[model samples]
Structure formats: structure tokens, C-alpha cells
Target: MQSVDVAYAEEWKMDHGIMVPLHFLTPRYDMDIIPVNINCQGPPLTPLNRVWEFGKALRRACDSVPEKIAVIGTGGISHWPATPNSVKIVEEWDRDYLDKWLANDKEALLAYTDEDTLKDAGQGGFEIRTLTAISGLCEGKKGDLWFYEPIPIFSVGCTVGVMEV
Candidate 1:
């Protein structure tokens, strides 16, 4: 997990590098103790365009390590998690996001720093960064849109899916 907070605290953008893997600190996920790449470069607060480098680094790790790796990038398709956006949801953007994922459109996927993502989609939409990176990691692989729903409780356009090599 690349400590984006720590890295950001030092005023650095996470370009390309893997951070120490941490044990599932909390019960949020039931993932194994194995290393999980945590790319925090794109958070709800300040999202950076580190997608290209971030994905490359993960690809490198997957190839270098002897263990089988399954990289799962999780985040909202759109919808800001805080502020005035807490009550809003962008189903259109979410659907389009899933569409791009299912189609494996890397170019379009990495090209979403538009005002819609922040202004309309809300700050939470920044989470798309992780999804963006994952798609890059699984370039040329087949991915399925397992499920998608915009839950109002959390005010996020949630997506559950898989990308298989």
C-alpha cells in the first residue's frame, strides 16, 4: 500500500513505486494477509494524474513476485463522498463508467479529469483513479461488470466487477 497520506504529507505525488504491504488493519475487507498494492494517489481530497505510473508499478510487482496476485481496485464510479455532494448521485456518469470498463476502453477511461467528474460527479468521483489504474494493470484482459448500483445511503455510484487475465 503506497502511503499516499505520508507521501502527500511530504508533498510528493506517488509516481511509481510499491509501498510496504500492511495486514488488513481493520475488518473492512476479508482479504488475505498477502501483499496488496494500495495506491492512494487518488483520494477523495486531492486526486492526481498518477494513473499511468501507478498501474505500471503494480504490473511490475505482479511479474516480479513469486506468488499469484489478484489486483482488485475498489472505488465509486462517481459521486462525491462529502460536502454538498453527500445527497447527490450521478447514475449517468456511473453507467458510462461501467460501460467503459466493460468495453476495456483505456483511452477514454484515463481521460476523465473533466469538470463533470468533480462538479457534477462530486469529489468522491476521484475514486475513479483506482479503477483507472486497475484497468491499466489488466490491459487486454477480459473484464465483466458483475454488478452496479448507486446506493443512496453512502451517496456513491458503487460498482462490483472483475477483470480476469
Candidate 2:
């Protein structure tokens, strides 16, 4: 595994990436959250392979603990955010990616290069690191897509899924 810094912040200012899901999933804000933010927003981004290893490590860590854990990966699929092409939904690309994700196809998921993601799925596609990580966490487990829709007003191919751990 690659060496990376893992720190705990006592005080964290929630961003939309963290807040939106919390708002809907834990609306009461009653559960504890250990937020893990991947560097999917900028360059020198975490490589897809490294992200997969990290996800595996995360699974090991979670398994070592007795507490019940819920891993939620939230991100856009194929919408260009903050760009002129914003609201454009590449349904085909999103669906293809989802297919690989649901199958937990490590080769196909990690095969995506940043340049390819940017060109084919747009910048927001980089957010797929989260999904890829989930694939790693579940490894051999297959996932089910409970919901998926391209909501232009929301500027994302909104998706919800669960891995069979």
C-alpha cells in the first residue's frame, strides 16, 4: 500500500459533499460520522489503483472494530459541474460505469485514467474515486443499484447503491 497521511480533525466544517448525504441519510444528525475525503477535486489526484488499495485498507480497519459501520460513497457520475457544459448528463457513460460498479469489476473500474475520465465523463467524473473505493471495500461482493436518475437541475446523475458485504 502507498504511504499516506491519515489524520483526525476534531472540528470539521461540512461541505456539500458531506452535508447533502447526511441531510438525507441521517436527517436527524444523530449518528457518528467518520468523514473520509479523497482528493478528487484537483490535480495530483489520488491514482485509481492507490484509491483501491486504500479502500481495501479501510475495509480491514473497519472489520477490526466491533462497532457497526456504514460506508456511504456520494458523488456525481457524469455531469460537468461549474463549467459551461454543466447539467450535461452522459447517460451512456454513467450507465456503463454503474454496470462495472455493480459487478465490483476491479479491472474495469481501476482501468479509468484521469485523462479519460475528464474527456469521457467530465471533471466531476473524478469523483468516481469514492465509488471505486467502495468497490475495493467490498472486493468480491456485488452491489445493487437502488436508484439512478439524471437530474439536470441538480447537475448530477444522482445514484444510490449498496454493496453486499
Candidate 3:
């Protein structure tokens, strides 16, 4: 096991990233939740390769416990949010990413550099870290893309998927 320092939030606010999905999946809001956030928006961001390793480590940690756990990774696919190109939705880029993600192609997924993501998919594409982590957790397992649509109004490609773990 890798020795890494884990930080805890003293005060937590349920951001839309977690709340929107939970609002649909757990309407009752009774179940416990542990939110994991990847630094997709800031400098010194975690590298894609390290993100994959983190996901693998997380899987091992979850497996060490007896309780049933469900991990949900939520994020926008390819859209330029809060920028002059906010209306832009890179459908081609999103589709290509979804293709690799569904196949759990680690090589393809990790091949993305921040510069490439920024150039092709815009800043919002950084959120793929969360989805890529899910891919890592389900390494060697394929996933299903249940729904994916570019919702210009929302400025994101609304996506829902599940990976076999």
C-alpha cells in the first residue's frame, strides 16, 4: 500500500457535483456519503497517471472493509464554462473520451495532457480526472454509457455511466 497523507474537511458544503447526482440516486438522502475531490481546477493538479494510481489505491482501501460501498464519479465532459467560449461544446472530444472511458482504456485515458484537454475540450475537460479515476478503480473492466448528451443550456455534456468493478 502506498503511504499518502489524507486530508479531511472540517466544514463541508454539499456542492452540486455531489448533490445533483445524489438528488436523483438517493432522494431520501439517508445514506452516508464520503466525497472525494480531485484538484481538477487548480494549478499543481495531480497528474493523470497518479490519478489512476489513486483510484487503484482507493479500490484496495474499499476492499479492505466489509461494508458495501458505492462510488459515484460526477463531472462535465467537454464544455467551456465561465469563459468567453462558454457556449462551446466539443462533442467530438467528448465522444472520443467517452469511448476510451467506457472501454477502460487506461493507456488512452492517461494519454491526455492538460494542454491537450485545454486546447480541445476547454478548461471544463479537467473534470475528466474524476471519471478517469473511476476507470482506474474498474481496471480491466468495461463500463456502459447509459446516457450522454450535449446540453448546451447546461454548458456541459450530461453523462451517466457505470463501470464493472
Candidate 4:
């Protein structure tokens, strides 16, 4: 397993190489893959159990592929509850979460609910997707912190990091 902090999808692809079994997973709220649902109110709240199901599916996909199971988690720094220093706080939380994640413990990762998470870091709730991705990758195995870098811009924050299982 290997890890790298990156910003752009092209950069990640360039580094990891083409032809990898890539799985781009993002929070439905922040996800730009499909048309943005502007009519939808706040970001969609994902049921914890539903996320677990998706994790299981991801694991099955990796098993089927058997190699080059590259999972990319995108988005960070929530945008609700409006507060100062939210970006920094979110970055810190993300770092700590990754630290625990590397240890292969889902309890710590899954303990926080979407509401609590959003209230804690405002827009940083966006980071939840990253946590979910890490959880899926770790899959009960120790995740080694490979990289961590937080970028704050436009009153928002974006953190890019990776871990190896």
C-alpha cells in the first residue's frame, strides 16, 4: 500500500498511472460527477449504515480486481454553521482522524454523526467523505499515513492525503 497527497484528479492519475481500477468516491453533497442538484437543500445526509454497505461493496470490487485498487476520496472543509477558523479546525480534525484511521479502527471514524461533524467544523463536514474512503480502504487493517497536506482557500478548506492498508 502507498499514499500521496494531491489536488487535481489529473495529477493523481499521472502519478498513479493510467489503467488503474479507479474508484472516485465523493459525498453526494459535494459530488460534481452527476449534475449538481441546486434545487436540493443542504448536502444530502448519508445514513451510517448505508455508507457501510457501500464500503462492503468497495471491498468486493477490490477483491474482484485483485490489483490496482485505487480509491480516490475528494472534498473537504464543511460550509455550514458559518464560523471563523473553521478551516483550520477541520484540517486538524482530518489529521487526527487519519492518524486513528491508519490504526485500522473504525469506531473512532464512525463515531461522529453528520450533524455533529457539521456543527463541529462547519463546512469541514465535507471531510467526512474522506473519512469514509479511508475506512473503506483500511477495511479493518492498519492504515499507515502516507501523506497529509491541507489547503485553505476562498474561505474554505481542502485537504489531500493518502494511506496504505
What TM-score does each of the candidates earn?
0.71, 0.94, 0.95, 0.57
Q: Rank the candidates by lDDT, best first.
A: 2, 3, 1, 4
Can you rank all candidates by TM-score, best first? 3, 2, 1, 4
**22-140 per-residue lDDT for model 3 (tens digits):** 99989999998888888888677889998898888889989999999998888888878888888889999999999999999999999999998888998889999999989988899
Model 4 over residues 43-99: C-alpha lDDT tens digits? 665554445445556556567764665555544444432456633545676666667
Residue clash pairs of candidate 3: none
Q: What C-alpha lDDT values do all the predictions have?
A: 0.64, 0.90, 0.89, 0.50
Candidate 4 weakest ten by summed lDDT? 32-41
Please name the candidate that would achieve the greatest lDDT relative to the true structure.
Answer: 2
Worst 10 residues of 3 by lDDT: 1-10
Leading candidate by TM-score: 3
lDDT of 3 at 10: 81
Q: What lDDT tens digits, residue by residue, belong to model 1 across residues 40-159?
A: 335443343456456656787689879886776766666656566575888987888888877768777877774667676776676777777777777777679877877888677556
Question: For model 2, how does the per-residue alpha-carbon lDDT over 5-45 read when each residue is reduced to its tens digit?
Answer: 45577887878888999999899999998899888889989
The residue ranges of model 4 lying beyond 4 angstroms of the native Cα positions read 1-43, 77-89, 154-160
